[model samples]
Target chain A: MYKIESKEVSLYYGDHLALKNISLQMKANTVTALIGPSGCGKSTYLRLLNRMNDLIENVKIEGTVLIDNKDIYARGIKIDDLRKKVGMVFQKPNPFPKTIFENVAYGLRVNGISNKSYIEERVIRSLQNSALWEEVKDKLNKSAFELSGGQQQRLCIARALAIEPSIILMDEPASALDPISTAKIEELIYELKDKYTIVIVTHNMQQAARVSDRTAFFYIGELIEYNDTKEIFTNPQNQRTQNYITGRFG
Target chain B: MKKIFSRLLNHLITVLLYISGSITSLIVILIVFFLFSEGIGLFGKKPTEDGFIMAVNKSNTVNHLNAEQIKLLFDGEITNWSEFGGKNDSIILFRMDNITDYFTEEQIGENFENLPACISKVVDSIPGIVAFVGKHYIDKNFAGKELQVDKITVGDFMFGKLWFPTAHPVAVFGALPLLLGTFWVSIFAILFALPLGLATAIYIAEVAHPTVRNILKPVIELLAGIPSVVYGFFGLVVVVPFIQNAFNLPVGETAFAGSIILGIMALPTIITISEDAIRTTPRSMKEASLALGANHWQTIFRVILPYSSSGITAGAILGIGRAIGETMAVLMVTGNAAVIPHTLLAPVRTIPATIAAELGEASQGGLHYQSLFILGCVLFIITMIVNLAVEFISRRNRRVAS
Candidate 1:
């Protein structure tokens, strides 16, 4: 069974239709990269998985988004619980103005997990999983703002992981970082898929080829193609997919 | 040629700008200088060319009297000389108006041109009389003796508990009660306004629908634009009577009434500033909080409020500054009783109210007039400190944000 599925989901921001009827399915423990040029609605599509679009005003959605065979958009599905199951990292490294330890611990605390020992154990495990523990462990009580951009991004990932979300959505998570940091994030993403289902939105084709198990190409408001990353990179599926992969046009 | 013309125009503009800036600075310096020069006189003995003095017949036993005693004598609370350590005679009151009553119209002249002479004649003739008139009218050649008056000291002006500036013999310039009242009303005002203002700001910035925000924003601004006198009238008609009935006080005019009125007056400032600060919190930060599965209230409390804490503090400080300096509404509602208030229910007077109420009648260049200016100086310093604190807090906020 698919771990996550969106069936003919359409999204409208006020009168402007941002996403057309786009259907996709993802298995557990796989990395799927949503690749497209700017303003192609890839980020908007990613946000819809966890209902982050609900934050915007006058947003309308049609059809269903299912996680673990249960429709998230259906009545009686609490949004906070859905969000706990689907974590997100933003385009920029946005850390809360708090201690590094507290930034990671925030998720567990907010979820009403009161066992301090359990929280401390989870925070350490999440930081180690994000590969930021060794660098930040010495200054766990220090402010998250004092970290380098790459470290801050890792801390954000650690924050997402601390909640133990089943699905992680990353929206250009390394776009604001240096190339070294981007590489680290890419490496971490490769390691992350063994434990979590990951969807990453990126404009970089090479990054998609280097990390994703499957690559989904989005154009305008439609998903043009979805196939094995190797096939999409080396072989032809659709003309638009080939063109975008080969840098013919956006 | 065009290049030279443009360069010359640029230089002229720069020069003009410098001149305008200097002129504003110069004017501010001059005003501050003038205020300090005149106000400093209140702290110590300063010779005056002429001031109103209490004089009596040479035979009167009272050698000197303090301001409170003189006030009692004039107010009819003290009717005899024995009440004020004087001869056992009836304390006859003489004023400029009674000059005509004492002498014939022909002797006094049509316009009271002989008023000084008539005053001297009355003082010399009436043994029990105490006369209050301008010092120039106290003829040295006449038998009426000018009672030596005590000068108001800075210690008395700053620390004295009573504020009776109109008291005779020597007007008391004590500002402590006014100071306490000002702070008392302002503290209550801040306590009343801060939470309401902050909550309204958060609602407008985070929770309110667009239509609700648009309507409420202008309504709050309109509240600020209403004349202070109108607010005073509202306080007098509404809040004062309510407090009186609720607390079973004899009079409605109390510090609480002034606080309510001032709190209402300070709301717009606090709301507008705090809302702007909350709105300026980065969209990405809020999104990050929400994306972390934190609910809306959690995001607002844990993230948005902390991030905008400095701005909110600055807003509260600005509100407090407004409350402290407010005059007309406080004067109208605070009962203007120049005594130290022990509770919110008591009638009180603030420094600004005292200055506003008496500056008109304080006789320019007199100690009372100078003392009012000193009150203004105190108010200026208080506001300056508050503003400086606001600047420091915002700067620190910026540093943390960066």
Candidate 2:
């Protein structure tokens, strides 16, 4: 069974249609990378799975987003439950102006986990899993802002991981980082897929090829191609995908 | 040629900017200097009216008396000189009007030329006489000795409880009542405004629909523009009566009424600034909190409120600045009684109210006028401290953001 599925989903921001009927399926423990140039609706599509698009006013959505065969957009859905199951990391390293420990512990605490030792263990495990444990362990009480850009991004990842979400969605997470940090995040994403089903939106085609098991190429508002990363990179599924991957045109 | 012209224009603008800046600073300095210079003159003048001298017999041991002591003695409150550490004697009050009792007008010349000698004789005969007379009335042949009345000291002016600047025999200029009044009213105003303002700001900035926010934003801003006198009027008719009825007080124009008026007056500042601060919290921060599965209220409490804490503090301080300096409404609503405030229910007077109430009646450049200037200086210093605190808080907030 697919871990996550979207069935003919379309979204409109007021009168302007932002995403067309896009359907995709992902298996458990697989990394799916959504690749496109700017304004390709890739990030918008990523946000739809976790219902983050609901934050915008006058946003109307159609069709169904299914996790474990349950439609999230249906009536009587507690959005908190949907969000807790699907964690999201953004393009920039957005950390709360709190201590490093608190940043990681935020999700657990907000979700009503009040056991101090349990929170501490989860924070440590999340930090260790995100590969930021040793560098930040000594300064857990320090502010998250004191971390460098790369470390801050990892801190955000640790924050997302601490919630123990079954699915993690990253929107251009490394676009704001340096090349070294980008490599580190790519490696972290590869490690993360062993536990959480991961979907990442990236502007870099090489990044998509290197980290993703399968790739979906979106153009304008449509998914131009959806295939295994290796096949999508090497084979010509569509002329537009060819152009974007080769830097022929955006 | 164009480059040279542009350079010349730049230089002209630079000179203009420099001149404007210097003029503003100079004006501020001169105003402050003017206030202090005039205010400091109050120290030079004695608390007694000009040419009024308190005299005693040459054999009397009392050589000095303060204004309060002299007032008590003349009011017949102090019956004996021993209370003031002088030789034990019953106090006798003497005024210039009592001269006829000592001698017939015909014994003095028709022109009253021999009145000085008679005054001398009266003072000489009465050893315990404490006489209030004009300084010019004492001549070289006068037998009475003048008791020294000390000039008003800064300590007396600051800590003195009485504030009767226009008292006929001697005007007292104690500022403690006015200071505490301003202090109590401001504290109560902020205490009322901060929580109320912050809650309204949160609703407007974070929770309200755009339509509701649009309607509320300008209305609250308009609340700020409404003059204090109008608010004072509202308090006078509505709030004062309500308070009077509710508390069963004798008068409505108590400090509580003043506080209500000031709190109402200070609300717009607190709300508008707090809303702006709450709105300035990065959208991404809210997103981060929401994405963590925290509800909207949680996001507001945990993320938005904490993020805007310093800005809210700056707003509260600025609101206090407004409350402390407010005159008209406070004057109208607070029963204008110059007494140290012990309770919020008591009628109190603030420094600004005292100045506004007395400036016209106080003859300019006189002791009373200069005393008003000193009040202005105190108000100025309080306002300056509040503004500096706001500046320091905002600067630190900016540093943290950067």
- What digit string (tens of lDDT, one per residue) describes model 2 on residues A1-250? 9989999999999999888999999999999999988998999999998899999999999888899889999999999888999999999999999999999998898899999999999999999999999999999999999999999999999999999999999999999999999999999999998999999999988899999999999998898999999999999589999988999988
Residue A92 of candidate 2: its Cα lDDT? Answer: 92
Worst 10 residues of 2 chain A by lDDT: A236-245
Runs of candidate 2 with Cα error greater than 4 angstroms are B1-26, B56-130, B137-146
Question: What's the true lDDT of residue B62 in model 2?
Answer: 81
**How far is each candidate from the true structure, as Cα RMSD in Å?**
6.6, 3.0
Steric clashes per prediction = 0, 0
- The residue pairs that clash in candidate 2, if any, are none
**Tens-digit lDDT string for candidate 1 (B167-212):** 5445666789999999999999999999999999999999899999
Candidate 2, overall lDDT? 0.91
**lDDT leader:** 2
Residue B386 of model 1 has an lDDT of 94
